[model samples]
Target: MTDDLLTRVDNGVGIATLNRPKALNSLNQPMVDALGEVLAGWASDDEIRAVVLDGAGERGLCAGGDVVAIRESALRDGVAAAKFWFDEYRLNAAIGGYPKPYVSLMDGIVMGGGVGVGAHGNVRVVTDTTKMAMPEVGIGFIPDVGGTYLLSRAPGGLGLHAGLTGSVFTGADAIALGFADHYVPHQRLTDFTAEIVAADVHTALSRYAVTPPASALAAAREWIDECYAAGSVTEIIAALRGHDAPGAQQAADVIETRSPIALSVTLEAVRRAAGLGSLAEVLVQEYRVSCASLRSHDLVEGIRAQLVDKDRNPKWSPATLAEVTPDAVSAYFAPADPDLTF
Candidate 1:
């Protein structure tokens, strides 16, 4: 196993800890490979009755995948980044389909790839410190790693609002939106994990589950549903802009800062994913968009501005929402070579 990931067995539990605390445990190719191999072994191991996944850090469970690494690879050759996504997506599918009871302790910032690892588990526990989002659009990419499947299934149109604005969700908000199964204080995580190793998964989780505080997203459901249910990105932006509510206007402003192509493509992906039957199906669709994104000028520019130069200002290809046409957006859905399959 790689030094970045720790794996062990205690009693009947298989424990995996993301060990790169300094980078907020952000996943790299090596870490992903180590995790996938370990989980595969535990899946068929009769001695392992349950699996517990957590990250080593005070700041968060995981920030996201190593986007800086992906960016560097993309700068040299697109194949490297594509290979990372292919492997990462396969790991995501494995986590979602794991036969054994899988529990995730999500204590802090869970976003993008972080969401894929934790949220897909059978039992997801969030704490007061948890802050989650699928903020891929900010970096000029659609939310992949089954994000479309998760977000599209959210009640009403809250998911659309979140996808478009890259809104952050608190622990309570995550449970409210069905992204998390339970809430336990951060202090109790150690004991809860130990309980899983000693007892049954359900019993251990029930022992620690607590009612989460009121969800901010729940309070804004009506506004989110009304504004985000529009037919297109332009329509949604117009609704947000015209609304008298401060939340709507603020959301609109945030959307404006993101790449127009990314937002438009994300909306299309979410809408299409809503009708799909399975995570595998959504992943294949996402793969197409992900590959297309690599070829787009925005992906490089966005990464350069956000990470390489730390400029925080990306000059998007389609500078305005109006410039992102239906044909342009549709091209992203075209099938890729060696299509992603279950």
Candidate 2:
């Protein structure tokens, strides 16, 4: 009954609207707990044939988890952070394995935690305005919520390009990258929403779905695959910097802005996740990385510069990519105390 999430049922379709438009529908702890409980209940409710997830306002579906709160918790070693991640990751696993048809209307800005709630659904709809990314490294955080899992499976080294650079991609890129199933223009959104509410998803999609516009991400795979498949982030950056392709140098610039520690850990995590057998396995890995990040110096500094101070400049320890040792990276993979059991 909290105001953050609005839920109702119509035509046997359970609908959940992320209600914090002012904050771009960023998820808070209560929102996470409530969403999990609601989804769990809907799983057993025979009257509910499907579920629909969307956000309010024209700005975006969601910005992400409440990072301002996360930053504060990190300042104190964040016992609260561990629990928040525990519940959030569990919700991610549930959504990935959700029994009923789960749909996410992924229009407008979707990033970080936004990708978690929107991308894992069975049916995801993107609009022309859709701008999606998993830009966790920029803030000294690894992509959690099975983000490494999703990015790991993207075609060629596109996932690596995305994870390393934290770049934004369009709806066409979303469809091409397997993060979404359909493209419905933004203008048709109201009609599409109405259709799904009145009838079933299939009927609504059949009429509304259309071919996506071109994907620059897909088109640039030739260079992206070659540059990002290098042995290390340093090597990849070198490759991008040397390559003569259109966006290669720009990609290198973006990667350099991220925390060296976060970048190293994230690169390894995505590679490991690619070999992982399931989303749950990847989530388990993400949990370990996230818990480790909760205690890291860069996580606090990154948030301070990026969010608190608005400085847009973080003085990272082990600032240079060369200073990041395997030991520093390995700590992220060590067994987190009290492992998260599926």
Assess the local accuracy of residue 79 in candidate 1 as a C-alpha lDDT between 0 and 100: 84
- Model 2, residue 62: distance off in Å is 0.8
The alpha-carbon lDDT assigned to residue 303 of candidate 1 equals 81
- In the range 90-116, model 1's lDDT, one tens digit per residue, is 889999999999898888889888899
lDDT of 2 by residue, 79-131 (tens): 78888888889999999999998989999999888889989999899999999
**lDDT of each model, Cα atoms only?**
0.90, 0.91
RMSD values for the candidates in order, in angstroms, are 1.0, 0.9
Worst 10 residues of 1 by lDDT: 69-78
Clashing pairs in 1: none
Error of 1 at 21 (Å): 1.1
* Model 2 misplaced stretches (Cα beyond 4 Å): none
Quote the lDDT for 140 in model 1.
93
